[model samples]
Target: MPNTVASKRVHVAVGVIYNPHGQILIARRHDDAHQGGLWEFPGGKVESGETVCNALARELHEELGIVVHTSSCTQLLEIRHDYTDKVVLLDVWKVLEFDGEARGKEGQPLRWIKPKTLTKYAFPAANTAIIDAILKPRDSSFSSH
Candidate 1:
């Protein structure tokens, strides 16, 4: 007899913490955490009853000790990838400003790297496009009065 079961997707929040220098922040996952020792944007899973933006704010504060105003975050992209054990949907955002300096509150190492240098780091599969998008310059249009 064959067994039937369904796999549930896991939802996570990710932040592209940037500075005026156009550097993006990356953090090393704790050795004991999932995908440990790998580098990624500083963020984590969204808890129940929390909006995506709210989760981003919370995760940033918890992981980096920075308090970001939820309204200031801009939705950058969403990534969906499948792992052998589970499917993950990462909601990524770009935080332009926040309070306090980012520290590895979780005992992880953090670095701010230019977008051009991101390719040199080994990130989870889902972050590939996110990095590309971050490197691309935003389109701007102006209207003359």
Candidate 2:
């Protein structure tokens, strides 16, 4: 039989986790990882045995040294982008609450930036949509965080 199964696309979950101060947490990719040195949200790829929410929680812990309850995060947006080696599908989340300080435990620099001011920083092209989403006004159901 000819090979008929399609290759599984690489998907990543990113969290636009922010605090009440209107500062969004962004992290620089480690020098060895893909798109290293570029500023992006704090998250990682979903592992084989974990759900997206679980992955997000784990990533936040690993990257930021913060423990976030999965229930506290909500899906904010999803994006797909094609790169030279692989296609990436990014599921972005908005984390309303978590525990512990967000340190760059992975040796990447972390910054808390105001959404309106994000455009001034250099980010991956795909991040433009994420920024736009952040800048849009929230609705009645929106939480301040």
Whole-model Cα lDDT per candidate? 0.84, 0.84
| Candidate 2 lDDT score relative to the true structure | 0.84
lDDT of 1 at 54: 91
Mark the regions of model 2 whose C-alpha exceeds 4 Å error after superposition. Answer: 1-8, 137-145
User: What is candidate 2's lDDT per residue for 42-125, written digit by digit as tens?
Assistant: 888998888888999998998888999788888878898876656789998888888999999878898898888888887889
**In model 1, how many backbone clashes occur?**
0
- TM-scores, all candidates, are 0.86, 0.85
Q: How many residue pairs clash in each candidate at the backbone level?
A: 0, 0
Query: With candidate 1 superimposed using the best TM-score fit, by how many Å does residue 56's alpha carbon deviate from the native?
Result: 0.7
Residues 1-145, candidate 1: write the lDDT tens digits.
3322126577898999888798989998878987788899988789899998899898899889999877778888788887776778899888888889999997899999988999999887778888877877345212221
Which predicted model would earn the best TM-score? 1
Candidate 1 — which pairs collide?
Answer: none
